[model samples]
Target: MNSATDVEIHAIKQVVATVEHAQRYELVEEFVSLFREDAIWTTAAGRLLIGRDAIAAFTWQVLPGAMKDLVPSYEVVHVLFIRPDVAAAKVRQRYFFPDGEPVTEEGGAPRCT
Candidate 1:
């Protein structure tokens, strides 16, 4: 609602955009760069990855050809600021085929937090 919040939202949107770009192009390094050194990532298949190094390893193994037949998209639907410097974003993820057909279940409009 304030200028600071607006700026943060804009920055978050940019991060979401970058994520979409990286996934669309399967840029392993670019995708991994979004995580902090101590970040933890849980894959959709329930694989738990701890730390940037682990994340990088997993990404390198998967991201390169992950998008060969599909396009991944991320949209930030909500952003909850727990504090001045801490925020949690909710992102809606979808996949589409190269021909623009939805690859995942149909859902409502995409959003991110």
Candidate 2:
């Protein structure tokens, strides 16, 4: 990985660790930390959730309920720069639910909900 990709991947890893192991409140900040101040996050449903504050609020609302599973495993399939200032990636994640439902695959808003 190039330096930029390495940094972004590292940032993602830190957020994942915080989300899985830290309290929900602690994760709110950690999630935002992975995003740029002017980041534009688009939901898979095509909703435009903009900026850090908006993202943080959105994260706080659904994190505890939908993300209490905490421990999740993801593979970064690809990361390509859209421009010098923009980059995007494709990730696949699997969650091992505590309820013993076996491994579940979830992404986008469904995971957030």
Candidate 3:
């Protein structure tokens, strides 16, 4: 991918930061607020959530106690500009222990992606 304009870069970064912060803190309402009313969200488990309302409903049900003792973080691996007004971002999400070690196989894998 070529260089993104400053505005585009800043906007994308803001979105990423917001999402990361929301997830790390289990801020379900804030996370849901990031999606558009007509947006579609697919769960890692293959559940399809259409519209912000459905997304919010699902999110609220599972966010709390989801992380428990672990912390979640996102790293933006790549960004592709699909259109002038639209972009697709690839992210690497990982869970870590409070001491900063990566959660391992004993943790039984990360859920609620």
Candidate 4:
């Protein structure tokens, strides 16, 4: 693996920011738009979602009002460049109550990366 350029790092951060924004606002389309057509997404629940259509279906069913009393935060902790055009980003995800207390135990809520 090669070290990512500053520009690449910034782009990864922007993608994470977009995810945070989409989740915070429950914008399903915006969230799903981030995935490639062949992307595979594994949910926090350990469900394996294959392909963009599968992801969209699952997200559509769950994202609306999912954050009614909570806020989600996503931060890009690391990015590994596998090739010039491919990178894997590790994101830290946390959920908080409207009053800002971390949702420590909701649905087996452990800090996710």
Collision count for each candidate, in order:
11, 0, 0, 0
Task: Please give the distance, in angstroms, between residue 41's alpha carbon in candidate 2 and its true position after superposition.
Answer: 1.1
Candidate 1 residue-wise lDDT at 107: 38
Global lDDT of model 2? 0.61
Candidate 3 residue lDDT tens string, 1-113: 34556678667878888987887899999999999999999875678999999999999998877777888777777778888888888777777988999886333337544
Q: What is the lDDT of residue 16 in candidate 2?
A: 55
**Order of the predicted models by TM-score, top scorer first:** 1, 4, 3, 2
RMSD of model 1 against the true structure: 4.7
Q: Note the Cα lDDT for every prediction shown.
A: 0.86, 0.61, 0.80, 0.85
Candidate 2 wrongly placed segments (more than 4 Å)? 1-26, 44-46, 81-87, 99-113
Q: Is candidate 2 or candidate 4 better by lDDT?
A: 4
Flag the better candidate by TM-score, 2 or 4.
4
Question: Which segments of candidate 4 are over 4 A away from where they belong?
Answer: 1-4, 105-113
Worst 10 residues of 3 by lDDT: 104-113
Per-residue lDDT for 1-113 in model 4, tens only? Answer: 33548888898899889988998999999999999999999987899999999999999998898889888888787888899898888887888889988887433334435
TM-score of each: 0.89, 0.58, 0.84, 0.85
Q: Evaluate model 4: give its lDDT.
A: 0.85
